[model samples]
Target: MASSNSLLSEMQFLCPICLDVFTRPVSTPCGHNFCMSCITCYWNDTPVCQCPICKETFEKRPDLKVNTFISELASQFMSLQVTDAHIWSADQQKASCGGAVLCDICTNTKQEAVKSCLECQTSYCDVHLEPHHRATGLKRHTLVDPLASLENMICKEHTRLLMLFCKNDQVLLCDVCAISRHVNHDVISMQQAYKEMKALLGDTEAKVQQMIQERLQKVQAMNESVKQSVTETKDVIANGVQDLTTLVSEIQKSQKELVKVMEEKQKEAEEQADEFISGMKQEITELQKTMMKLRELKQTEDQLCFLQSFPNSSLLPHTMDLSTFSFNRHAEIQHIRKSLSKSVSELKMLLNKMNTEIQKFSDDTDVSNNTMLRYMQQFEVDIVLDPDTAHPLLTLSDDGKQVKYSMGSGLWGIQNLNPNMFTEHLAVLGQRGFSSCRFYFEVFVGGKTEWCLGVATASVQRRGALVRGPGCGLWAIWFLEDKFETFSSPNVPVHFGKPERIGVFVDYNGGQIYFYDRQTATLIYCFTECFFTEELYPYFNPCDNEYGSNLDPLIIVPVSRME
Candidate 1:
């Protein structure tokens, strides 16, 4: 029996279909043996009956017959190996009892699986997994954790394990897929792709955090601005209320003064009436006594006394002559009325002056236009001449800081005008142009008899007679002869004195241009609500030189700091 068991162990009695000892062994016409049920099932699943091991074909269906001799041999082999198989199974169960994945091969007692083989797409217990670790054929199979869903890790189209990443398609690919459909695509190892994607995710996370911080900062700044705006609004309201209160108090004081004067005039008139009534009453009392004495003398008992009293009528009160008691009310009140009228006129003058002052206060804070210009001087710009835009007759200094008209020698010396020159106007534009900010420049017109200086938009005509007015995109003031004038629609005259150094301020955002006398800090003129759409340049015209009368150059002056 020992000799038979040793021979059976060396013999090949395992079926290729089940990889185990064959049960109910059968033989076909091709002379290959297999389990009867396994052969039938294989043939039924295929188009033709063929041997699985040798690839031998059968032309016709052949009746299967049990190979009794091989069956007995396989039964004896299984019985002999039973003790060793039981021992191996027991060892595998003991080794894998703690794991979650149960081995598929351990039928009698299910045990935990140690590793999953990608090539077989099956999980195996430690005992069954020994083939992958020891055998050369199974050693090359990929192993991983005992995964629950091995199907998810497989390529459905190729029915192969996914082991690569296709960068072109941004998808996971199997080895066969990478070689076939994705051969020309960018592909990388799965591990390498995973590391790169993790790095990218970390970078993205950092950027998102930075963006969050930036937005939070913006929110905080906006909140602060809102708070500041509210605070400023409250302060403005409080100041305005205080000013109005002061004005009201002034009006109340004027009213009291007016009432006091009127009351004094009325009291004087009442005192005059009271004095007239008292004089009339004293005269009446004297007349009543004279009449009582006259009646006593008329009784004839005192005829002599009556004659004596009548004889001295001039000595008694003159009852018939009431001229001394007459009240000239108009004469009494005329002086008071005249005084009240004068007081009213003076009060009206005071109110008028106050109204004018209040109007001035309402229009602008204590700061005058000159003060505003001084404030704007902080944004003063250094202006230079642009020779390209100057008229042919105009000569520019080497430093481009001054320009003056120069007529070439003859009485009517006509110089050839270039296309870039201002043909009809003796105008030159500054080198720098501004479109959206505040800028100021000063031009010295000290000895020039006639000159024009201000800002002009880029669209102003360069070759023809350019209208120096707001409608033509030119906001300017001019000094001609002895008069100062602003080039408005109708050329309004400016009453301000001539300024040797004229400061031109342009506020593009505010749409205004202000002219100032830098020497006296006085405003010459201002062009308000100016519609500026393009770049603005400082415009200067010395007005044809005037036969040496206006020969002085228009010099661009530097702004000086205030003390």
Candidate 2:
């Protein structure tokens, strides 16, 4: 039986073209057996008729015949063989042990791995893993699910199971390694480390998602800001265009009126010239007629007759009115042109002022405040103290530029007091007054603890109690008891440091007053939309000396222009 099985296995019954058991086997002229259909299909595809296995050629295709004896022998052998149809296929072999993890102990015929031993760094099948479950020595091996790389489960240096995690070095460690190199480091079991690391990863992912959301919100806000800016810019452009168009129309109207005035003067001059020419022509014709009459009188030889005729003749013209014809030709036009020129000069000045305002709005430099101060300096006034407007308890300097509060029984005891003097409040007014233009002045309030400085209207109370506020015709900023405040409807607190020199600017036409710290050029406070029907004077109040704390005199300083 063994000899017959060996003989059947060694038989060559596969077709070379199909590489499988022959089907309808046929013998070619070269004695090579092949599947009849396989050879016929091969011959039909190629130009030369040849045996596939032997490469033997033929002039005409052979009439192939089946090998009956070989076919019968192959059929008998196939029937006698014990064929197992349920054998493992190639794919199944690869899934089990051919391509997957194989048992290390199954050296003769490798089998699929079932479990892995972390301690031994080896894999084993069910049959070979029995020792791990039975033997006490093998039972100590840490077993887990089958893995391809078991070597990674052991420490390379210590040759021991990596059962611990070293957090300081961020590496895996063994029990022996933990006691040696990682003894001082933070170490924990691998399971605990894995759980902690997974939790941290979750937190990191959440943070990344939150950051993405925040960026998206920022993008949306930026888009909204851009849209609003574009809208506002368009509105500004439209308004500017309208304003320019209106200005051009006004200029054109003024130009036409000026030209009309000049044209009228020119027409009057031409009319005067026509009247002068007509008068001269009539005189010339009368003279010619008189000469003809004289020649006729000479023919009559009578001088007396000629003299009498000349006195009564129509040729003799009456005294002509030359004064009208001798009038200045350029007088009318000159007067009109001068008036037009003056109007144009005023318009030029207005345009220059408008240009300056536009430049102020467009300038983007840090020196804008300084530039404003310099411009305001042109309106600087030399402020002097008015003794008549000062409180009787206040003392003024000889130069009338400084004043301070006097605590004595007052000037009423020494000299006659002015009725207009501030008798209740320790305040004083400047000598000069402004009614319409802008003016700026600075006061040195250094070393003063309590003081007030600003502008006051002419009608401000001078005799009894006084109200220190804008509504009461007083616009001022005061420093009292370490607090800075501005006088308004309701006193407003000013957030500013103590300044040595205080600048006061009053624009009567603009109905505004501004206070500034001269040293830093920083705005301290402003009074806007103030109604001033009378003249305004710079007001100063050096509060009563409280134990000499407010002794420093309120000195009026000159404004220094910045280059």
Candidate 3:
């Protein structure tokens, strides 16, 4: 049985046309056997009937019959091949299970290849791979995993394994190519190049992660800003609604009072007309009674009786003087209407004038406070107060940007007084003076009850009892008793809300000084048509301490540029 199995393994059981174990063996008249379907298809495609092995032609197509003996032999050979494959390693059995590389040596049955020999450029199943492990010459052959294509792993030019990389050419190289053509082309081992590429990839990944985190933080910040903006918008809408509702209510109340006054005037005119009518009717009744008595006297035919009963010819019955009495109901009502109409016309004119100013203010409100302030900040100057020009009762900050009233009056030691010192006024001037061009600065006035701010001419008097006004060469505004006043010729009152910060802008060529509420961006006051003949300096006054009521320092805040 063993010798028979060996002979069967050596026997060629594969059909020449299909190159596989025959499904049904057939014998032609020429005595050659092939797969039944394969020979039939081959004969149908040819012009003449012939034997594939002997090249013998036949006049007529020969009838074919299945060779049962040969079919049985092919089936036995297939069974034997599978039994031999099962004896191989378990890994080879699994590899040959499905979709595995077929061994080139197996003739009757398909067997999965376990390894590929690079030297022979051929794949071997475990059954055929035994020679490589046992034979001395075959053991030196390089083997790798089963590969379908080996051309890609070899350098096409040198026909050798690609073991090196040419950095300059960005291509694979073999040892022979590296020494002959790529010697000076930055050649490096494939392993070395892989390490460098992996390190670079790791660094790139880190940078990408950092960029992602930064973007996420920016998105979070932007979302928060949007939320804050939404909150502020809602607050503004609520305040506007409340203020408008109050104004409308007051207007309605005034209209009701106007209606009540007109109604009262109408009621008075009606009452006076009723009194006049009553008097006239009483007079008519008395006249009618006198007429009836005269008729009775006439019927008696007694002239004496009639003449005695009649009212005296010289003395008529007492009655109202109708000729002199005149009640013009319409005239009184008309006079009231005319008076009200004149007043209403004047009121409308005043209301329209007020509306014009309100519209202007509303237009200015369209620009946000930050926007307007940022615009003005472009012209901001670095102002430092001059110690020589500061008042004795005022304490200056080390940075020369703040000042406040000294709490202890006698704490200041007597020192050499300069001509620029303020002897009476608790004021200070900036160190830098502007003779031309425009300048702007901001001051924090919060927590202070009284303070003064403006620009003054350098030639102004710094002596005792300094007169504060333009006529005295000093232009300034001061807050006292909760009232804002500009120190002009006669001291004009300014109507404005309490401001926490004040921004002062001066147009030297235009000769104007403008004050603005920094928080609201609302215009506080403006001094126009001024003639400046000398250099101007920033002015500040903390006023009196008033037992700590006005002790908060006036800070010259730093300004930053905004885009």
Candidate 4:
């Protein structure tokens, strides 16, 4: 019995089709477990012998190696069950008086009826069950052992069945589990567990690879970007270094030029200083000579006093002897006085001559031109943005001092031009040369129309007056009325000389010009039509409180008025 149990445990006893104890052992082409009755029933009574698990058909039946071990184990299990049933109360009721439990098939009919067979594990009435259990050759028909049915089953956990599996941690454990134990434990659906796990593992693997690949690409791109940035930075720094070096060189050159000029100025000053000192020294020498002359005069006067003091009383009392001495001495004193006067006069003339020569040498250089170096091109006129032949030029702000410029050509304004004033004011052009107002919007007025426009004195008075020269009045751009009754100021203000598209873009005070968009303002366009332009050469700025040249705009763009 032990050998039979051991062999049955090694042999696979259950039929594949029934998943139960084999009904009739049979062999397939693969020599695996099968039951003749089970396979034949599923084969639809066909002659084909096929492997049930894979459906691989065989042309001929393989030799049936009836597993003696499985047969013996089955017989032993059945016999043990039957023998145990003889002691049962239900089986004892149907036993013979000799203690033999007889099948009703071999026993006599009793008044009491018995139905179920304990040993056969079947139910029947006393009339059939007794006979069924008592059938001579088939009394030992197989009965299942319930307790042994599940004894050999093992769980996926490699433990006993009826156990729990933790999901998060992928671990199987016994039934004494707490929430803490399963907090990170792997649990699963017990019935469809393997199929679910296969799908889950495949999905996880694919997702992990995808994420890793995405991150890898990102890292690579970042590294490349960093490298490019580093290269660009290096280039920028190199450019900066070059610019710095150039600036330093330029500064050094300027410094050298400055030093050279300064030294030349210092030399001139030194020469002047030396000339001044020499003159002073010469004056000092003359003073010393004059002092010597004065001392001599004092000595001669003392001598004369001494001679007079030994007077006429002691000598001959105003008489003949005294007359001789007085005559001789008087003539000598007169000669000495004449000599001293001549010497003093000569010294004065010498001092005066030296002072005159020194002054002539000192006043040699002209300081005006060199000091005002920046104002070198005092007469150069810059033709900023030309007269607008395109759209209307609108001046945003003009105080006749400074102008704000904007070109509202699109939804927004852009391309700003900045404030630039002429060294000589240009608000009124032709301050030096003549300027022509040819036509305003291409409306031609016949003949030599001379529009002498000038800014005359306004009540407020313009601040930075530019055209303040003789023959010019207040700040204005007026067109000369060729006809006696010509109301050109109000009628045809602008003349571009011919019938052409021209726009006025300026505020007199703000000094701005808008030569681009037409939709911004009609006032500016009206002013343009009012512009009285005349052709003249060498225009002069009159000495009146007239127009000043102040302008504003950072960048300027021109547009066609017609377009």
lDDT scores for all predictions? 0.78, 0.80, 0.80, 0.41
- Tens digit of lDDT per residue, candidate 2, span 1-563? 33665565536766788876677888988889888899989999999998777788999999998888777766665655434322335456655663578899997999999998887888999999999999999887778878776798878887677889999999999899999998899999999999999999999989999988878866886788699979988998899889988999999987897788668877887887888788789987987877786677768757776666655545455647666457686786688779878988998998898788678757854357767677777889889888888886788887888888666543323213898788888889998889989999999998788898888888888878876544787888887655579765335677547788888888998778988788887777887657789999999999976635786789998787755
Q: What TM-scores do the predictions have? A: 0.35, 0.39, 0.34, 0.24
Flag the better candidate by lDDT, 1 or 2: 2
Cα lDDT of model 4 by residue, 1-563, tens digit: 23567547435667777876665566666667666667667676666767768778777755565656666766665566556565574665744333322333434553222433334433334555444557775565432212111222223233234245566656554443424356555555454456777899999999999989978977986898699979988997799689768967976886697578657866776676676677667766776776675565557657766565443443212222323322243464577569757866996797688567446435533322221111222322322322211112223222211112223343223223323222223222222222332211111111223322222222212234434332333323333322111122344444333211213323332222222112321221122212223322221111111223212221212332321
Model 2 alpha-carbon miss at residue 323, Å: 4.5
Q: Give the TM-score of candidate 3.
A: 0.34
In terms of lDDT, model 2 sits at 0.80
Alpha-carbon lDDT of model 4: 0.41
Residue 502, candidate 1: Cα error in Å is: 0.7
Better of 1 and 4 by TM-score: 1
**Per-prediction count of colliding residue pairs?**
0, 0, 0, 88
Clashing pairs in 1: none
lDDT: worst 10-residue window of model 2: 407-416
List the candidate 1 regions with Cα displacement exceeding 4 Å.
Answer: 1-370, 409-417, 468-470
Give lDDT for model 3: 0.80
Candidate 2: lDDT of 499? 82
